[model samples]
Target: MTDTLLTEPDAGNASEALHEDRLWRDNGWTARVKKNEDDDGWAVEMIKDGEAEPALVGPWTMGRDKKNPKPLDTGAFNTLVKTASEVLRRHEQQLHAQLHKRMAVESGDATIEVTLDIVPDEDDPYALLTAFDSFGEQLAQVKVAPNFKLSRASAASWVENEFRRPG
Candidate 1:
């Protein structure tokens, strides 16, 4: 006996339907359309699998037709999901790389100076990047983890905690 695996066709119509409905579904992300509570525009919610809530949420613009979206389907949803996820992933990687580069730990004679690079993390709006020194001291910290960011807050906090001027 031979095992046969079933595969679904990549249909444009299906994708169109989802796109019309303002829903995008990808590998592990789903972008849904919702009305903005404070304004008349629409909002997008990116939900990831296994997450209790949306991974990201932001405003969305109307389509070329300048009309509200239709019901979302598998195809259209998938494409949007893929695009949004890729954008977010790239942004996160950029932030991580930039943070590592900008937050340098330099020691001169007896004192160490700290710097902070801040950038926005669209996916994790509330989270920040922080770097520490060998003595568990913070060098820099940033609230937003964008393509280029540092954790100056963490560094300052660490310094304050570890090194206090004599009164």
Candidate 2:
């Protein structure tokens, strides 16, 4: 898909000169550029096709010309969307791994035994990674879905709450 430049004629000469562009939509991802409401600068909005809202919105930087942008082409916008999605996905996976890695469960041993089993959901893409003990008891579960990000502080708090020992 080719990029289409959509400019508002009534927005005056300054807005017309800004040159807004709308990139292609692929696999539920679309990229568009528009003038920022607050400033003369431009902003890029990455909207997912299936969703009712945009997945990401950020400031759009001008090209080397400084006066104009490089233009939002399909190839460049698609690559950017893919990279952004991948980064978010990996971040979620890493958080899930770290949260489950520190847990352990053990019973009937000279010292208390510890074992941790983390099961990622294959059927449901958005399902959480559930942590289980040696006896198959659930300890904690974290949503590794790209849209559901688990912060380090939240993960640590969950672990503390799950594995808290009585004094």
Candidate 3:
């Protein structure tokens, strides 16, 4: 076979290994060195526990024979776990940025900070439009359509209309 696996179960599923030449389970992550389908080289995939897809995948090193992948040890597994966790963290940050927005709107004598946080509920997706004063006191909050476009002109109009729920 082009690939070799050594395993049992994972922490999320069980307390063991699963597949690949060198499979390791620790800290809610599993690193598996698998066969690279594109070339004759080897690749490693880092999968987080309970996730359907791998968090990171990259090329792996060859052994002394230059044929098989280097066996994964404690050090390598720890590094993979750190890298995978960072990847997940960055992904979460990006998603948060996409779903939430904040901006400052000059309303009369005070500057109002407006924020739009989107809730992507499969059944009832919506957005919360909230306004905070310069002193960080919440002024008003309204539920709006998830597809509401949060822009400078729109925010100004909303503030001008006394923070009415967007139509």
Candidate 4:
């Protein structure tokens, strides 16, 4: 076997370290507390590595004296990470919901699934409405306005009306 060079990971660096001004860094994320521009209070900004925008930014707790912002600690860091991660998760869920809408409608002797997938465009947004039979076979696809609303009644009517492309 050929000789190979290997090095152990930096286990000691797993925890966040306070740099200055309530700033903490660790595990590819940075938590920063700064004076709020609008008021005398403080704000916290959590930024993930390699991203230009911050993952989360919110109010920071004041110290026990209630004059300065609280110092960065491991507990605070973990809470910030959790809150930032939740923000990212909610954003993704909202985006997914906006892009795709699905419903099931009863048709003749079977139930069909209808999905409206929005394709966003700066100039003109549009959506594709697709129908699938009970066996998951594509029945039809039609393009419509991005804001097109679909309901069970509408889907049922569409399936009953010969799958015509909606105008």
Return the TM-score for candidate 2, rounded to 2 decimals. Answer: 0.45
Model 2, residue pairs in steric clash: 104-115, 105-114, 105-115, 106-113
TM-scores of the candidates are 0.36, 0.45, 0.87, 0.78
Model 4 residue 74 CA deviation (Å) reads 2.0
Q: What lDDT tens digits, residue by residue, belong to model 2 across residues 1-167?
A: 33455542232332122223554445556666766777767777765554456667778877686755557766668676887687668877887775444333232341222323344456654435454555566655545453333444434444556544212
Model 1, 78-97: lDDT tens digits are: 65667667877887898676
Candidate 3 global CA lDDT score: 0.84
Q: Model 4: residues >4 Å from true position, as ranges?
A: 1-21, 50-52
For every candidate structure, what is the RMSD over all alpha carbons to the true structure, in angstroms? 12.0, 10.8, 3.2, 9.0
lDDT scores in order: 0.52, 0.53, 0.84, 0.80
Who wins the lDDT comparison? 3
After best superposition, candidate 3 residue 56: deviation in angstroms?
0.6
lDDT of 3 by residue, 38-89 (tens): 9999898888877778999999999999998898877888888889889999
**Candidate closer to the true structure by lDDT (higher is better), 1 or 4:** 4
Ranking by TM-score: 3, 4, 2, 1
Q: Candidate 4 residues 1-167, lDDT tens each? A: 11121122133553644354476677777777878888889888887766668899899888898988877778889899999989989999999998999999887678899999999999989999999988899999989889888888778777887788765
Residue 93 displacement (Å), model 4:
1.1
| Candidate 3 off by > 4 Å | 1-21
